[model samples]
Target: MIKAADLPQTLAVFPLPGALLLPRSRLPLHIFEPRYLQMIEDALKSGTRLIGMIQPNPMRGKKDALHHIGCAGKITQFSETEDGRFLITLSGASRFRIVEEITGFSPYRKCNVIWDGFDRDLGPEEVDKGFNRHSLMLLLERYFSARGLSTDWDTLKDADDELLINSLSMLLDFKPEDKQALLEAPSLTTRRETLVTLIEFALRGGNSEEMMQ
Candidate 1:
């Protein structure tokens, strides 16, 4: 595992299937299951309250599955209701690669992780503006209109690069492999290209029914 100079000692991790998180976004999670309830308690007690969210691949073997990339989320805000359930809000942190799952842990799973430098600046580069962003915005408008969903366009338009990419990645009806590809994308540019292509395909309106297929 690649360790950063300022790496924290421990992290809270949640192993789930089909969930992805990204930086600068809020992941609101409901913690009611026994194992996850314990995870929350351990995180709060440890004072870090950070959760590494990763998903398993199609393979059933825990040791043999899971993509290499995932986002780390900090437990920014949480509340335990009278019913003993946890309502927690997660603020996205840096991305991490799970070197391997650590053994000898009870209740919650633990893994040795290496930071993938997602927070580091790749230097200022020109964003794709020609046909990509423009076409995406138009199709996005139509897609939302067709679904009868209301959104604050002003807010979405003003979102920063990371927010825009991650938000769209999370909400879009992309296939699992496509979603994993976005997660594994080395740079925002690559991720954006994948998204633009997907949106363009969606805009064509022929294969829209196969969103998950």
Candidate 2:
């Protein structure tokens, strides 16, 4: 396990919207774009293998404006396909806050990141007190029914609280801003509540755009 002290001060960031990677979670990505391919090569050669996964602000123009907070993931699985694309899985290590953007040698964006604020991510998952697991499960059933989604109930039943929350938070088709809100939630309790509220609103026939507003 990588400690907070081992994390780098600067990180190469991938500005992708609606992609959420939480600490201890794994996100698989396909690197095909020339710039990102170069970024992957550089990371492998440099042996950092760290990439900050952040959401881009749609309100901003073509510029690479990103959310302040993001999770830094280390490349745990890497393979090159026959067609020149890189298939890799990143294991989330820690969350970071962007102190500032810096000019970098690589075409991909780089930012000076601070990990002190999110050092908790390096530790074990903290269960939120007073979390109503039953209610959440019930709501998830309704949400899935309404969305016509199916799942393996047996497998889902065996998942721990943190995995359940983070997996749903990432895999659910929530708006990008809502996903960002989930990522920015100060604690697991708040994140759980926020997710429940969003599901309730959806059940009430509220659209994501209105809920966000």
Candidate 3:
């Protein structure tokens, strides 16, 4: 019998090269890899189907690995396909750090983790009487224009902070380092500043990765 300690306190960890999952958001995952598929199975059997979603530092060598910060998500909704694949929805839970990966887990990767010490405390609210909000909307309109893409602005304007941030983070093809910075920032103000900086760089046609540094 595999003791609870024998396995990582966390059931599964999914790593993406440039994605960040933050609290109060949702991450949709389509599980296909054999290891990760098994991970989903194990998580279903466990009490908390919480998975840590993180990104690898691509600038590091192949042998080098992921950054230290990530978010834990509870598997709130899931559907298994007839072909044995999983389409799952993860609602953000809290942040965590990998203590270490279990040495020889076959068919799945598991790791011990410590929460990033988030007290679930909300951050200082900025009264967005809609200036920065409008600025963002305008910039996004122009940003998408050059790429010839379109979105429903009326819908976007009504989205709450969590929706606004998560949607933008997922859709934007930001550099890996910038994504990591957003993940590790302690508060919303910091995250917002980092994003503004990125937008300014994009307006100047500067490389996103360079702006991160």
**lDDT for every model?**
0.69, 0.86, 0.70
lDDT tens digits by residue: candidate 3, 89-115: 887667778887766746755677866
**What lDDT tens digits, residue by residue, belong to model 1 across residues 107-141?**
77777787756644212332444335555678789
Per-candidate TM equals 0.79, 0.93, 0.84
44-110 in candidate 2: lDDT tens per residue? 8765688999999866665768888999889899999999999999988888999999985778999
Q: Model 3's lDDT to the true fold?
A: 0.70
**Best-first order by lDDT:** 2, 3, 1
Worst 10 residues of 2 by lDDT: 58-67
**Comparing 2 and 3 by TM-score, which wins?**
2
Candidate 2's displacement at residue 154, Å, is: 1.2
User: Where's the lowest-lDDT run of ten residues in candidate 3?
Assistant: 121-130
Question: How close to the true structure is residue 66 of candidate 1, measured as C-alpha lDDT?
Answer: 67
> Backbone clashes in each candidate structure, one number apiece?
0, 0, 0
